[model samples]
Target: MNFKEQLTRFPILETVAKAAAELGVEAYIIGGFVRDLILSRASKDIDVVSVGNGIELAERVAARLGPDVFVSIYKNFGTAQIRQCDLEIEFVGARKESYRTDSRKPAVEDGTLSDDQNRRDFTINAMGISLNKDTFGELVDPFEGVRDLKRKIIRTPLEPEITFSDDPLRMMRAIRFASQLNFDIEPDTFDAIIKMKERIGIVSAERISDELNKIILSPTPSYGFKLLYHAGILAIMFPEMIELLGVETIDGKGHKDNFYHTLQVLDNVAQHTDDLWLRWAAILHDIAKPATKKFDKKVGWSFHNHEEVGARMVPVIFRRMKLPLNEKMRFVKKLVRLHLRPIVLSKEEITDSAMRRLLVEAGEDIEALMKLCRADITSKNPDKVKRFLHNFDLVEQKLKDLEERDKLRNFQPVITGEIIMETFGLKPAKEVGIIKEIVREAILEGIIPNEYEPAFAYMVHEGEKLGLSVQSTGTTFE
Candidate 1:
């Protein structure tokens, strides 16, 4: 297929062709841009490979396109970059690579286009379109990448073992691409990843997490997790998650496999929202099940307080995975702790008081929490799913009504310890805390409106009962 029409989107392609012809250099649009174009997917980043110094070609192209075009050159890596409008174009010299056993960094040497294509990670990315005067938009497919694209397969241009061994991160990339594109990994390539799973250790945590995030953001993340688990890469990289697999039975009672259940929840949430932290909440919602597993004669299996336990485990897991320990981590922790709250409300009589507490605790994350609770319904019985969903709607309605009336989302008590201290003419002490707790409980329990007058009256009564009287004249409750 002719990609000449696609190149018309950027007028600079003509300038690049003219410049390459003048300099006697061969240039082509390669890698992801080519692959995405063939698949009819939209892409903003374009990569170019040239037979001569990529920096020189980029400089000439930049000169032809005038001063507004910016060209950045990295001499050591034999690469250059150009930014124009909304497009970022990266230029690299045609080169071959050979890797040492212990490191992923490749020994680079200048070579022909064929050598460059041979070094690519996958067949889909190895396809290129020439920009020389003789063949301005002819595609070069040394590995029959077009056929592979038609068949929807992810296979390396070179030997699978050698390709993956040279850069173990490609193994993850292969699976990530399969998940993203809904393609299948060829049997030999899949086995190669399994055999070379140990080599993934050489990859940096940041790089691995980057790819994992992409997989998590895919339409169905369970595909990527299954591939990772089957290839043994998940065990090496994320042993904590791998441990969630399997069911241990005692006296003919066993808990469900939390690992598979987590994946199912993840996929279900992915279908609803693309928020990364919410997806993470799904992954970790039941993380403590294995740790808190117990069995009783009457109860088949129980994971008591898994939410609290899982909340405590979030920081350790984030640290191990090299994820940020900022508000994002805290958000996921909060969701894990409160994941079961909505479910409990669904089972019992939905109450405004319980919904108010949930809203206050969840704050802005209440909707995300509800989404997770809905996804957690993984029952095989259709009636059970329907009943839970119907109850969940009622619970959501109660939450909305309570929030509208009480304004309790992220609400703090109107009464403060400072007011208590001033009214009782005392320093910080247990009496002040007791008064504050009583007022807060009174407001939450609907015994008193959240207005200041009622809270102040209740505070005074509690303080008087504790043998303290108002001493400051100006400190009347506002």
Candidate 2:
């Protein structure tokens, strides 16, 4: 494809061209930016490969763009980045690499542009466009990248084994790209990934988790997941998900594969929300089924307390995967634990007390929790699915009505521990906790409205049962 006109789309390319000519070095726009340009996809990050010192070229270009343009240099990596408005232009010297068996980090040295293209992960990403004065907008694809792009295929620029063995993270990127673009990985390259799947052990957990998170956030994550499992990468990196894969049969009765079931729920949740943590919750919602699976003559099969067990596993998995162990982790844990509560509430006789408990427990996250519960209903029979959804609608309406009337979503008990202590003239003991629990439970159980008077009266009565007397009368705790 002739890209002469496209090269003129960005004025900075001209500035880069002038700098390359002045510095007497060959320069080109290469890799994903060129591939994306050919695909008519919008991309702002430009990768510039020069035959000489990339930092010097970037400095010259930054000078041309005026003092306001900033170039951030990474001396160790031999790369420089220029921030020009919304565009990020990365400059690197074309180079060859040699890898050691134990590490993914490669030994780097300056080389011709051909050498750089030879080391690229995929043919499509190996495509480049010249920006030098003599060869402006010339397409360089020694690997037949354009043809592969036309075929909607992912293939290594070199031998698949050598390409993947050099940097094992490319394996994850392969699946991520396929999932993102809905393309196919060439059979040979896919087989090479399976052959070299163990090479991924050299990659850091943080980097692996980053790619995993990207796959999770993709439109159809199940596609990437299946690829991972087939390639054996999923089993190595995340065994918990693998544990959910098989179904056991007993006495002509069997449990549906929770693995595929979880994927369907993930896809279902993906249709409605793009929240990464919520999708993570979907993935882990039934992760403990393998551990909790049991068979009974009467019930056939049951995964008792799987939600709680799965919730407890969240932190361990997050820690192992190098995911953040903060509120995001807490969110996933909370959802995993409470995922079944709403399902039970929907399938049974809906009660205000149950709704109130859910509202208070979920607080501001009730809406998101309800979305997950709805996605969890993956019945093939339309009538059963419809009935569950109808019951969910009733539960949702009750939540809205009760939440508005009682304002329990963010409710705090009117009786505080300090107040309980002051009222009973006691220390911070179990009695103080019991009295506080009574007031909070009373408000949530509809024993009284979340108003102060009834909560206070009930608190006094309970305190009296504990053999404590109120020090003052006609006094409000509000």
Name the runs in model 2 displaced over 4 angstroms. 473-476
TM-score of 2: 0.97
Worst window of 10 by summed lDDT in candidate 2: 469-478
Best by TM-score: 2
TM-score of candidate 1 to 2 decimals: 0.96
Q: TM-score, each model?
A: 0.96, 0.97
C-alpha root-mean-square deviation, candidate 2: 1.3
In candidate 1, what are the lDDT values of residues 354-380, reduced to their tens digit? Answer: 877788889989999999999999977
lDDT at residue 133 of model 1 (Cα atoms)? 78
Q: Across residues 263-350, which tens digit of lDDT does each residue of candidate 2 receive?
A: 9999999999999999999999999999999999999999999999999999999999999999999999999999999899987888
Candidate models: Cα lDDT each: 0.90, 0.92
lDDT of 1: 0.90
